[model samples]
Target: MPYDTERFDGDILFGHNSLQVVYFYSIENIIRGWAQHFRHDASKKSFYHVDTAIFEKLWRWARRRHRNKRWQWVKKKYFPKGNGRSWSFSGEVEGKRVYLFRAGNVPIKRHIKIRAAANPFDPEWELYFEERLVYKVKETLDRQWQRWRLWKEQKGNCPVCQQKMNPETDWNIHHIVWRSKGGKNTMDNCVLLHANCHRQVHAKKMTVLKPCPV
Candidate 1:
């Protein structure tokens, strides 16, 4: 007697790929399993089967239109690139012709590193992960201030005036505000002056020279 295989329907058990025919308790479980297997392992040639009869009917209808279109699109857009050869769907629902690279060639470890560095707050991390670069620079006058600390200790006076002034009482940070009112926070914009010289610069009682912009 020839064993007749009826087309799948909502509640029928159908054997696939010579496997044991088992009734699935729910269609949802079968569909979910198909999605997971497809994402993780299905490639240019791999696919899975749904034993539930209703799903099989729906799958056949879908295969004629949407599935076939998607398979064609995948071949063009998302196909893996390496050799000159191209891959296409074999249309088999089980253990189809598929290509698998060696485990070492896969970028699983690099993907792990990317996931680790990802910032949770960034929405882009939900798509892909990468790192940001940052740099910091210090101004020259700030460096000079540290070098002048020894001079203040020895002379206790403004370098220009040579008048005996207390280090704590006279030394002040000055900004040579520009004629265009462009004040900079750089060391060149600053000068160590005695309190009187500092007041003179601000009060404009003496010549107010604009410091060169660094």
Candidate 2:
């Protein structure tokens, strides 16, 4: 995903107009490129790939070869979990463990604000958001969901005024425990209050809401 690295000069295009395709040589080009390109640096010049069964065999061989506790510790951290039929292998480079499960996808909500630019040549039909737009969109959606959930938990009432609240401009998440009192940033430590109620509580015009267990 680190596509901005200067090492790459854009995708290798193949075929002509009707059959044009972009080739992003990932595992083969990037992984091997790292190993070959950094050969002078022993700490960074390492790569490994093998079936689960082969990994187990190699692990046993390595264990017997080293016969020391350091190898045991390293094995525990670098080895990938294996299920009977086949194994997913892992390797290490510069003290970093490279494993298949190290990366994963998180659920993202639909419909979120994103900044984009349209292609000048295809302005009416093509648009693009620079790298990692999906991640940014997910983050925005998560914050919106958190705010809405907090509003729902408060039963749409302003804790200070003890009256029904309006969403247009009244809802805000207020910390139950004063931040100066070493309160943690957590859902249980917050409550939804009207913006006016928040100002009143801060100004001593309204009492602070009691810290309720969430």
Candidate 3:
């Protein structure tokens, strides 16, 4: 059983009045263990892929059991300095009991705080997860690039020279406008240009434009 454990600093106080009962266990450990137990084949050593429903049931069961044991211990040892009846147990359910421990007139807040262990397998898991995410991003980018290329081919001729366009290496989409001149990346702003004509347009613009337009 591959499990990770960590010390939890906080305690859980249940019932109407608060009773301090500490619980310690990693929810991640419980999840991984549960996944491994219900894996498809008993003999085969493969990664587990349990459904979310089964995982939730197992996690709740484990939490309840741990809480029950801690509650019993606190209930047995509740002895305040002045009060004889320091604490009271309401009832027990599924091996766990609810207790009430009062401090003066006001009751302490009931809360359960569990610290999760730093998973050693997290780096490996992230590597796989990120790879999948990047693959989807790249696929979308490639499709958009192809669409832009096809649209440029259909636009007929170069906008600058008004010459017929060639598909292969000659025709390309020119930012019919320069992006630095507040031009948008939309297809309407783009124009098809032959490779040499596109080069001439850029070269001429660079030499003709004044360095300071002010």
> Against the hidden reference, what TM-scores do the models get?
0.23, 0.33, 0.26
Q: What is the C-alpha lDDT of each candidate?
A: 0.37, 0.44, 0.38
Candidate 1 vs candidate 3: the TM-score winner is 3
The sequence of per-residue lDDT tens digits that candidate 2 reaches over residues 1-214 is 1222333222211211111112222322543444434333323112222122234444554455456668646465435454221333354545554443311111213344444554323312111221122234234555666567666777776767778877766355555654444555477776767666665665563445643536
lDDT for model 1 comes to 0.37
The number of the candidate with the highest lDDT is 2
Report the Cα RMSD per candidate: 24.4, 18.6, 22.0
Per-residue C-alpha lDDT of model 3 across residues 1-214, encoded as one tens digit per residue? 2222221111222211332232212333343444444332232222222222322333333345456566445445431223344433233335665432221222222222222542323432322332333234333455356435533555555556656565444444455445545555465655545656656666565222211212
Q: Is candidate 1 or candidate 2 better by TM-score?
A: 2
Write one digit per residue (lDDT tens) for candidate 1, span 1-214.
Answer: 1111142243233423222113233333444444443433433222222222332453453344345477555454323343334531123226443322221122211111344666634533321211111001112233555326533443454544657666445345544543224455454554456656655554553443432223
For model 1, which pairs clash? 8-53, 9-53, 9-54, 10-54
Clashing pairs in 2: 52-87
Stretches of candidate 2 exceeding 4 Å from the true structure: 1-141, 210-214
Which one is best on TM-score? 2
